[model samples]
Target: MSRHSEIKKTVLRGVYEDNAGIPRSTHGKRQSKFAADSQEPVHSSRYPGKAVLVAVLGLVALLGFNLRLVTVDVAGPAAMQVVEEQPLPSYRVQLPVPVSPVGALIPGNDQLVSPEPIQSLDDATITSGRYDTMLTRLGMPMADLFNLQVQTIVIDPGHGGIDPGATGHLGLKEKDVVLDIAKRLRDKLAVTGKYRVLLTREGDRKVFLKERVAFAKENRADLFISTHVNSLPPGAGSLNYVETYYFGPHTDQRSLELAEKENRDSDYAMGDFREVIARIGDTLKTEESKQLANSIHKHLYNNMKRRNRGLIDAGAKTGPFMVLLGVEVPSVLIEVSCISNKAEEARLSTPEYRDRIADYLKTGIVDYLEERAHRRTIEGGIIQNVAKQER
Candidate 1:
């Protein structure tokens, strides 16, 4: 056979051997070198191993691609950021910082934001800037005016002119005694430069109850204090004491009779007093006047008792007097002493005693005003709290 025929026979022989599940080798073959080499047997096992290796590599590559897709940040690009963590929700409230009255609560963006946690309007705080007070936000001034201090005081010296009032046995006239006291008190208050003190009558002149009230009203007095001396009836025993009276219905028979004596003038009738009382609601005016009376009586009684033994504190009482009628401000009628008593009349006759009494009255008034200012501060705080809650 020719070499080409020999090569074809070698390939066909290998195919037939492989198909028949037989192993073929070139070891004993009698053929040319090319035919012998072509007759080498193919290993089916090796082919299957290479195929498996390729399939496994392809599967691994697919799995790796799927894992990359799952791990990618598709939502957004990575970026650097700084942020304040939001606080947990809370209903905690903190008291606002106490802002003094030295400066008005300026309604503007310039005011500082309260670092204190506050219950905000919409329950969430604005991260942009500070929070302003409700009043400031509304552009309303602080109600400091509502918390007023005692300024102008009207001192009415009772029983001037035709009315001599009660005269002591030593001829110590109630009008003269009280006028001196009022003048001394006015001077004392004026020297301090804290008050504007005015008298209804400067000298031993006549002044009607109506005129006195009108003077106080026209001047816009913050307080009205009428000074007087008390005397008992013929049968009543001489009593030495201090008494303070506020305008109201009589608290007792003695008060009623005293009111009658003080209300004798023709300026205001019983009907007029009735009208004034009817117009009053819930006795607020009466309560305020009573407070004034109590304050004065406390100081007057305490101070006088030091010098005058057995000096009684008859206590603050309510009595309707013409001088106090229709007077809007906190008013009181103080019976500084009893002219009916021999010792008290003797003391009233002296200038030193009168000066001392004036000093006591001044101190008492100062005490009342100080207490009132403190109370007003507390009330202002409450008003602020209410305003905060409302906001």
Candidate 2:
């Protein structure tokens, strides 16, 4: 080949081909062309490996960035999803957050606060101790507590207003007589200033039996005394007597009958009242009332000088009388005297006789209080011992 042709061939080969073949004249020509064209020439010797290294590094960086995005997409977006059904093996996907530890729970603001890292509900056992503590703190009233000296008493007057209870043939009503007696009783009780006495009716207003009981409960009255007059069946002599009644779950028939009659209004006959009484009869079935009745019965008989019916042995019965059922306190009904009998009713209408009854009741109340004070002294000792042991 001619030298010029050989040089051209070598130049073309050096321009396009890798460092496999080369000639001095061709290399010079290439360098001269590059210089004249004002183009920067690359040093191929160092560039190829560098290019490969850069490509490999760039590929690795792209792969790492894509992996990071994928991980975030998998974990970050579904954190708040609720698990509606129990997780089965197939469905048990790992959550981003792990279950919180039980040790994280600490009391805050008088309540338990979870201290452990919270991830799920499966971490700790729920406790009822908080509720139990609250209930323990909410105990009985200070008045009923033996350590406290507060005493509560409730006074109930039988019949009022339109219900002219037990109208004797002499035109005297048991309602008026009982009210007069109640006022006098209140006055006498007030003079002592030791008992907290509440009257069921302050005026000639007719309060329902339930209302009387509720009044006692709302005030947390310790003792409930309902004053009324008695009525005897036909052919019985016009004898004067005082009767006391207490209520229980299943009281004597005579006790039920007496409570029913005394509670009856003029508008309703005995039959109608009995039906009304039947529905509520079971309410007073608790055994506590029997003790209450016994206490009142014992005091009344022991204090009063009048004809004693000797407790009537009614044995703490229950009936549907509004006044007795549902009264939380110890309750008793006092039939001071018979208003149905003409002579007895006439005497009840007199203020002097009413005052006499009031005086006798006041004495009974004092005796009951004295007994209660003694009992409370004993109970107080027991309670202190129990509290110390509990602590």
Candidate 3:
């Protein structure tokens, strides 16, 4: 009994101390409310715990529902509005574009435009003038011109077919006369075993001067020789002459005059005027050409006939001769003899006389080869011997 009483007294003392700071009336009210609540709380129902858990679950569900909602934006610009919800572009392409007008493909003036205006014959003067101006521009001459090792030789018999070269007296056609002579020369040259010769026309056929030059170039001819017969008034006495022509400039004025006369076909053919002038000018300055002409003339004069006109330095002559202009190789027009003279024409018609002329030409060619070979040997250089064979 005493122990129970002591325990109760301790409990009462602690409760009194806890409520010591509170007002007496409030402490009495709390104690009375707790006593009433303690009387009913003998067993816990757990209903309040269940309700609090339900409230917490409801708040979590609300937050989750708000987070799942999607957001959309109205954008500016039609192009932007069409974009998807991605970070990368949907298309890429490469396109070819037309080129704008650029600088002139031709050198010099820069303002040259594409689809340029069509130039009339007169309007094209500037184009031609440009070529003329190139003369003063100065550049290295063609290296092949100085290179002596060219291997091909093309020979053109002046007239053939409908276009008979020079008509001779005594019912002799110029075409037939020159063809016979060319054949003889070809045969003689073939015997030397030096060149592989090509005739522009093998038989009676008209070959344009342009076509002749083209043939030579196509064959890569190192030399081009056009053979023809000359004509003059009566009483000129049977005369035979061998002349060598280069592009331009005469060692003597007479030589120049002869070249000009021989090249007069250029005017009839309407050849390139500017190119003709330039080529002639350039030929005139070449020392090798003068030597070549003299060498050929010398051989013909000595072997063929003492009266053979010696190498006449035909000065640089200008002509529209189509064949001459087209040739990229050393070229010459050989006017063998005057067919107008009765004696010479009679001689030309004979196979024996033609063979003789061929023999003389062969000798001259041999001389030329021998001299060129010696020069090359002395220079310790290669000699590119042009080759011409008959047939």
Clashes of each: 0, 8, 23
Give one digit per residue, the lDDT tens place, for model 1 in 225-312: 9999889765653668789998876678888777778777745566667765544422334545655676678678878988877787
lDDT of 2 by residue, 48-81 (tens): 2334434643564465422111000111112213
Give residue 372's lDDT in candidate 1 (0 to 100): 56
| All candidates: TM-score | 0.62, 0.53, 0.52
Please report, as a residue range, the 10-residue window in candidate 3 with the lowest summed lDDT: 382-391
Prediction 1 global C-alpha lDDT: 0.64
Best prediction by TM-score = 1
Q: In terms of TM-score, how similar is model 2 to the real structure?
A: 0.53
List the candidate 3 regions with Cα displacement exceeding 4 Å.
1-148, 234-242, 249-275, 283-288, 306-320, 381-391
lDDT of 3 at 370: 55
Instruction: Judge candidate 1 at residue 250 and give its lDDT.
Output: 67
Cα shift from native, residue 77, model 1 (Å): 57
